[model samples]
Target: MPELKLLLKHKARTLDEYRRIGGYAAFQKALAMDRQAVIDEIKKSGLRGRGGAGFPTWIKWNGIPKQKTKRHYVLCNADEGEPGTFKDKELMESTPHQVIEGMMIAGWATQADVGYIYIRAEFMDCARAVKSAIDEAYAEGLLGKNIQGTGWDFDLHVHLGAGSYECGEESAMMSSLMGERGMPRLKAPHAPLPTIAGLWDSPTLINNVETFACAPHIIQNGGDWYAAMGASTKNSRGTKIFSVSGHVNKPGNYEIEFGTKLSDLLELAGGIKGGALKACIPGGSSVPILNAESVAKAVIGYEEIGEVGSMVGSGGCIFFNEHTCIVALMWRTAKFYMRESCGKCTPCREGTDWLFQIHDRIIKGGGRPEDINLLKQICAQIDGRSFCGLGDAAAWPIVAALKVFPHEYEYFIQHGKSIVDTPQSKLMFPYAEPVPV
Candidate 1:
């Protein structure tokens, strides 16, 4: 109903303040219990991955081999590269210890010998905050050998990537972490699951920053306690932090419980700014765009959002006002994906460029009559044909825009101008440099 600040409960800046606000209490409670019990608590909590894919968190934790024959490693994906998403960055910056404690709990649950936080290079402030928190953790015997005298040991490290969006993918992050190119590897069925063979061919557990940040909470409050929060949704449980941006008046991160209305999130961000809401990308740039009609009925759960023809992807909710031009917005989005494509596979490498070319021409008033169908055809070809999700990510928004705003493309192509014929809409592409006389 309102902002549920489970993870963002306190803006605790230091380890001392964090402890005063009951920060590592969950990790301490976890230490006294069996590792299976720790994971079982997560299982009962019904917490899903806070990353784009809402996979069940406990399954990944439990997937690690119980025998522990080889070294186990835990990985935190701090590379927040999704456009319109900044929740993970805020989590790392504001409550660094919360994230560290969560990872430590994961290390204990999975019998991990070491853990690494793969942060983006641009997040230097977040890196320094987390690094300082880690230093504080070691000084207090909360980390390193014989942690808290439980005879269990875990070493945590921070790694910064060279700011590649492709590395945000789990396998790609692992590749970059191992000093390889920032490209994706063959996933399950073709290769072993990351849990079975990741980061130097050993058992590894990888979860994003927000997913790990939820661990401490789940461990502290019993599983049942966490599960009850989002009972209104079919399966989505607990709270999710959404990074609201674009036309919202007070754009920032707002944590809301599952089953909250999508419109409610907009209101929490202080409503639309320049004009009335026209459309919204309920997730990150990669998810389908929802028209205002759909947004009104959309609920903030994984399945609920899907029912409205979008996904709760990465919790990057971007609202577009009435003055916005859907075609121009999509053109910019296409350009981003095209530039960020890793070029690892033929479908994505070649297909993304094609998509950007089409959008570029259309937005520049050179669109052919068949350009709309061509865009759809290209999206179909690249949706699932590529090596990884990047292809799908590149294709989804284009496909959604075409479906949701068909008239925009049709009118823009037919008249060589946006149908939203407003002075504000003309200003949308202000970056177009003046032609020299």
Candidate 2:
């Protein structure tokens, strides 16, 4: 498989080391080009936000208003709080300089005079690394005040958020950075969108760690170099670093081009840990779960994952062996959402709690026949009705669990719990061997 680890090359820490590997040459190239040309280059790359939403990177930057009187901000969303996801944390700690360079490129392209990295407080190492890189950049005239006599001044800062998952959202992140509660804002019409009114109601452009990190490379190696790497399908593009975990024998980060099979990815991760692969969460905790049958058909791009009725969220693939209990797995997943819900909306705040409680009851041998039906009902209200993506994201996997493995819920409802004690225990969605199709 062709791998594109633009920001993963080792020994590229200090400015000199980074320059040796052709580091900020792209920025110099970018500086020479017109601002619109830089934006066009990024747009041509077909790079989407690696932060789950998969939004086009250039469109977000292009949306920044060209008003000199109003402040424009370019932010790097490093608050990687998704369960079963940790790629951004590693990127920040390892290739801090790459991230800084990417941010600088974005700042220049968007005409943003100021930039900030809103990293979670839990990522103290990431903070240190980014802050250290920022200082190094300032000393070398790579950041702050004037840059290489371009007369474009860009100041960068690192703001530590209080480790709230809600703050991972762009709106919530802006709120947390402003020293306010980390809750999602009420999204309104596009007359004054985030590009025009964000982070103190100014034109702001935000991109996740991986998304920004791609900028320097895309600029260095032309848009065609990146657009040619990933799936042939229209949406998912470029190589993605998936944080593989759960039940996999060799769970770790693996960068592969899009359109790879889920089963092939499992082989890359050394297959199932101790038993047959029963199911897998193709994306992070937020996306829907893929059944054993569907997993066989599932591919490794956003469009393909969507075709399987799941999302390529954060590229966090979590495997589950046949021995794993579906109800218990979902119960734990629901509990995470329940605890992490920002309580900003009535449906999400209350609905996540209800989902967790129901899953708990089903797993604890206290489920009623109507429990699964009721769960489906609660998920309906929470799926699209929530204020932010959190509530909608939390409801997706639960709904997927119901669809792909109805027997798991039925078994829990009948037996009051999942008991894989005998061969008879393997009822529906059996994957004793999980052979690739």
TM-score, each model? 0.98, 0.94
User: For residues 9-77, what per-residue lDDT tens digits would candidate 2 score against the true structure?
Assistant: 564667777888888999999999999899898888899999989988889989887656788898999
Evaluate residue 250 in candidate 2 and report its C-alpha lDDT on the 0 to 100 scale. Answer: 89
Determine the C-alpha RMSD for candidate 2 after optimal superposition of all C-alphas.
5.2
Candidate 2 wrong stretches, greater than 4 Å: 1-4, 422-437
RMSD of each: 2.0, 5.2
lDDT of 1 by residue, 83-104 (tens): 9999999999999999999999
Worst 10 residues of 2 by lDDT: 428-437
Candidate 1, which segments miss by more than 4 Å at Cα?
A: 430-437
- Supply candidate 1's per-residue lDDT for 138: 95
What's model 1's TM-score? 0.98
